[model samples]
Target: MSDFAIGLCGIGAMFVLMILRMPVGMAMLAVGYFGTVILNGTRSANALLLTETFSSASNYSLTVIPLFVLMGNIASAAGFSSRLYEAAFAWVGWLRGGLASASIVGCAAFSAVSGSSVATAVTIGRVALPEMKRFGYSDALSTGAVAAGGTLGFLIPPSTGFVIYAILTEESIGQLFMAGILPGLLLTAFFMGAIAFVTLRNPGAGPRGEFVPFEERFKALLRAMPLLLVIVVSIGGIYLGIFTPVEAAGVGAGMVALMAGISGNMNREQAVKAVSDTVRTTAMLYLIIIGASVLNPFLALTELPATLGETMTAAGFGPYGLLFLIVLAYLALGMFMDGLAMLVVTIPIFFPIVTAAGFDPIWFGVIAVIVIEMGMITPPVGLNVFVVKSVAEDVSMGTIFRGVLPFWFAMAACLLVIVVFPQIALLIPQAMFR
Candidate 1:
């Protein structure tokens, strides 16, 4: 069989393994390894595997993953995440659908630290869901809000999505992080607007929160300052060029660890648990990266990306048409695939096509992350929805799915705005890097 045909078969086998409950990393690795052995010799495949594994594991930039993850794990263990939610609630919970809106704001804030959608959803959802429930908010609206809001974790600074995208495309992590800031804030606002629209349509779905006194609100903000400061310093330092992404992550992690120790909010056991979790999460991410590293060269050997790019160009689609197709494909894949897995798998195929069409790579990263965020809340396989369901066990999956629909539209709207005015994603990065 032709090498391109073998590559297609390899992809199909990877999906089959994934369907059979094999881990995504292992699936990619197995497929890539065997595919390479078929196209090259066993010696070459073994060498590729060993070299990529070490290189990916030892990648200096990737240290940012573990450090930022440790920062988030420490924040959660120390109750800093809860404080962030409280601050958001105190300020915004008095509005219509205020609790839900606060959840969105909290997700955005924690996302700067956590960088994982699942972590953001769990941290904020655990805090916000119960309060929304107590306030007599509809389960659909409450659960949906948290699930959809959690997607911000993938778009905000310190985003794992951007980090992986940077590694895959060889783009600057700092530039991508800066590109995400404005788009992330824009999406957060759009989510809040969604909550308003929902509450307006069904007053009972989200009752107005009792007014918080200004003093109390200020105090809540003060309590949340530790995390806010970490976020500002780490993410802000990147924009100011005072720290590379790696240094920013280290500083953020150290600051959080110091605060946790001094504040006595994280006990020894909690600290240990935080470290363990960070290691586990980091390992999983590293494995995925290694798998991608192996698979990318195999794909290149098969000439799949080049062939796909040529086919796309020959199809006579304009730049926007190609982009629209890519977006639609992402949306469809989002229904069934994990966001990160989808990112790793599709980027090799899509990135070349996107860049070749004269689209800005940084802007496309923002757009890609946003679409992946949409998938987090998309039904059937909505990973964020499942995370929310785990938190709100009393709420049905269908109700949560229903809840995310409005926010899903909000996401689509955000995507549209960014596409029309690419500057929304590019402006901050351009200004900072210029």
Candidate 2:
């Protein structure tokens, strides 16, 4: 059989393994190794496996994943996430649907520290959901806000999605992080507008929160200062060229560890657990990266990406048109696939197509991350939605899904804004580096 035909069969077999509930990394690795053996020889496949595993594991950029994950776990242990929620609540809780808005703001703040969307949702929802419920906020609005806000973890600085994308596409992690900033903030605003729209349609859905005295508000803000400082120095330092992304991750983790120790929030046991979690998460990421590396050469042998790109070009699908189709496919994939897995599996194919069509790789990274965010809150496989349901146990999955619908549109709106004006994603990176 032709190499291209072999590649097609390999992809189909990989999906079959995935459907049988095999781990994503394992499925890819198995398919890739055997596919290479078929196309080349067993000797070549063996060498590729060893080299890919060692090289991907030893890469310096991979360190950022564990460090950032540690920073988040430490911060969560220290109750910094709760402090963030309190500060946001103190400022915005008095408005209509303000508690939900506060949750989004708190999630955004924590996103700067925590890179995982499910972690952000669970952390903030633990603090905000009970408070909103006590204040008579509807389950739909409250859960919806938390689910939507959690997606910011994928878009904001320190994002694991950005890290993985950077590693995959060989783009600058810092540039991708900067590209996400304005779009993240823009999506936050759009989510807030969604809350307002919901409350206006049903005022009882979200009642105004109690007014806080200025003194109390200031005190709340003061309490959250340590977290704010960590976020700024870590992320802002990267933008300012004071530190690389890896350095920033190390600094953020160390600072959070110190703060957690000082506050007596992260005990020895908690610290140990944080480190263990970091290792596990880092291992999972590395396995996926290694699997992708092994798969890439086999795919290259098939020349499928080049063939597809040429086909599109021949069909007169210019950059924008091709991009539109890619985004649409992502939205559909979001319904069934895990977001990070989707990135790991597809960017190898899509990145070449996108860059070949003259799209900026960094810009495409931001756009892809945002669509992945939509998937996190989209139906069926909306991971953040399930995270919220786990927290708000009495709320049905349907209710949570319904609650998040408006915010999903907010995400779509954000996508439209960035597509029409790509500079929204590009502006900061350009100014900082140019």
Candidate 3:
């Protein structure tokens, strides 16, 4: 059989293993190893495996993953997420759908610290959902806001999604983090707007929050300043060329840990939990990376990317057209597959097509993440929806799905905005880096 056919068969085997409940990383590893042995001999395949494992394990850039994960775990353990919610609520909880809006703001803030959307949703949902329910907010608005807001975790700085994207495409992790800033804020605003629209249509759905006194607001903001400072300093350090992405991750983790210890919030047990969680998450991510690494060499030998690109071009799909198709595929897959899995499995195939079409890799990273965020809330396997449902157990899965519908469109709008004006994603990296 042809190399392309062999590559296709390898991918098919990987999917079959995945469907049979195999881990994504192991499935990829299994297929890639055997496929490489088939295409090349055992000697070459064994050598590739050994070198890839060694290189991936010792990769300096990968140090950022664990550090950032530790920062997020420490932040969660120390109650920084609650302080963020309180600050956001103090400022915005008085508007028509203010509590819901505050939920989005809170999620955005927490996302600045915790780069995982499920963490953002679960963390903020625990705080904001009860408050919204107390104020007679509808389940739909309250749940939807948290679910949608959680997606900001992927777009904001310190994002694991961006880290994985950077590792896959060999793009600058710092530039991708910078690219995420405006788009993250923009999406947050769109979510807030969605809350307003929902509440406007049914004012009773989100009753106004009690007015917080200026003094109280000031106090809340003061309490949240430490969390905000960590975010600003870490991201700002990157933009100013003051810290490499890995260094920034280390600084952020250390700062959050020190603050937690100083405040007496991270006791022996909590500190241990934070460290354990970080290790577990870090291990999972590294496994995925290794799997992708093994799969990448096998795919490169296939030359399938070039063939696919040629086919697309011959079929009259220009850059934009090809991009649309890829985005569409992501939207469809997201309903069933995990976002990280989608990113790792597809980047090897799609990145080449994207670069070959003369599109910007940084810009495309932002766009790809936005679409992935949409998948996080889309029905069936919307990961964020299930996360919210788990936290808000009284709320049915269908209700959470219903709640996230408007926010899904809001995400779509955000995607369109970035696509129409790529500058929104490119502006910061260009201004600061250039």
Best by the TM-score measure: 1
Would you estimate the TM-scores of all the predictions? 0.99, 0.98, 0.98
Predicted candidate 2 versus true structure: per-residue lDDT over 5-60, tens digit per residue: 88888888988898898888888899989999998989999999999999999999
Q: Against the correct fold, how does model 2 do in TM-score?
A: 0.98
Tens digits of per-residue lDDT, candidate 1, 317-382, equal: 989999999999999999999998999999999999999999999999999999999999997899
The Cα local distance difference test for each model comes to 0.94, 0.92, 0.91
Tens-place lDDT digits, model 3, residues 68-115: 888988998888989998998999999999999999999888887788
The CA lDDT at 319 in model 1 is 95
All candidates in order of TM-score, best leading:
1, 2, 3
lDDT, residue 203, model 3: 96
Instruction: List pairs with backbone clashes in candidate 2.
Output: none
Q: Which residue ranges in model 2 land beyond 4 Å of their true spot?
A: none
Point to the candidate with the largest lDDT.
Answer: 1
